[model samples]
Target: MDMDVRRAAELARIELTADEAERFGGQLGKILEYIDKLNSLDVSGVDAMAHANAVYDVTRPDESRPGFGLEKALRNAPRKTADQFIVTKVVE
Candidate 1:
C-alpha cells in the first residue's frame, strides 16, 4: 500500500489513527488487486446477472377479499361509535 487511506476515511466521514490507516490501506490495496484480477477475466459470452446464482420469486396473484366490518372491528373496543372506535381527544 500506497492507497490514500486518510483521504478515503475523510470521504467516508470516519476518523482513523496512523496505525489503523496504514493497516487499512494495505488491506484496501489487496482488495483492489483482487478486483483487478477479477476484471481481467474473459466473459464475452456470459450474460449480465444481478446475482451469482439463479434467483426467482415464488409468488401468488393478488386477489381482493371481503374483510371485517366496522362493527366487528370495534367489538372489543372499550368505547366506539356506529362505524368507528372512539378514543379520548388529546389534541386541542
Candidate 2:
C-alpha cells in the first residue's frame, strides 16, 4: 500500500512526507475496500443515472429586451473611443 501510494504520488508529480504517505495509504486502502463492498452488491435491476434526483430546466424562456445603450454602458469607462472602451492590449 505504501509503495502504491508512493508510485501514485510520483506519477502525479506530488511530494508527500513520510507521515502523509502513511496516512494517505491507509485512506486509499479504506476507499478500495469500500469500492469492493459496493462491487459485491447486485445492481442489475438498478438503472444508471447522472444525478440522485430528477433534474429539469427551471429557467425562464429567453425574451428580447431593451439593453443599456452604448452611451450609458461606456459612461464609466476610464478611457473610450467614440463608440468603444479603450483597454490595454492583453495579447500581442
Candidate 3:
C-alpha cells in the first residue's frame, strides 16, 4: 500500500510537505490493514440485511383540482401586458 503522496497531492491540487506525507503514509497503512481485516469476515451463512425494518406509507389517489383565475392573478403583477408578464429579453 505504497501511496504516492506526490500523485495524490497532484490530483487533489495541493502541496504536501515531507512530514505530512510521512504522517499520511502511516495513517493510510493502518486504514488498509483494517480493510484487510474486514475482508476476512465470515458471512457465508449470514442473511444480508436481515436487520433492516422499514415500510413505505400508502400513497393517496390523485384527483383533479380547481385553480385560481388567471386574470385576477395577473392583476397583482408589477409588469404585465397582453396577457403576458412583461420581462426583459433573455437572449441578445
Q: Which candidate wins on TM-score?
A: 1
lDDT of prediction 1: 0.84
Error of 3 at 78 (Å): 36
For every model shown, the clashing-pair count is 0, 0, 0
The lDDT values for all models are 0.84, 0.88, 0.81
Instruction: Kindly list the per-residue Cα lDDT of model 3 for residues 1-92, writing each as its tens digit.
Output: 56677787889988889998889888987887778876778889887773467656787679767766788878889999888889889999
Off by over 4 Å in 1: 42-92
Question: Comparing 1 and 2 by lDDT, which wins?
Answer: 2
Sort the candidates on lDDT, descending order.
2, 1, 3
Q: Kindly report which residue stretches of model 2 are placed more than 4 angstroms away from their true locations once superposed.
A: 1-15, 61-92
RMSD of each: 11.5, 8.7, 11.3
Per-residue CA lDDT of model 2 for 9-66, tens digit only, reads 9999999999999999999988887777777889998999999889998987699888
Residue pair clashes in candidate 3:
none
TM-score pick, better of 1 and 2: 1
Candidate 3 ranges beyond 4 A from true positions: 41-92
| Maximum-lDDT candidate | 2
lDDT of 1 by residue, 1-92 (tens): 26788998999999998899989988999988777876788999998989988899888778877788776777889977766778889999
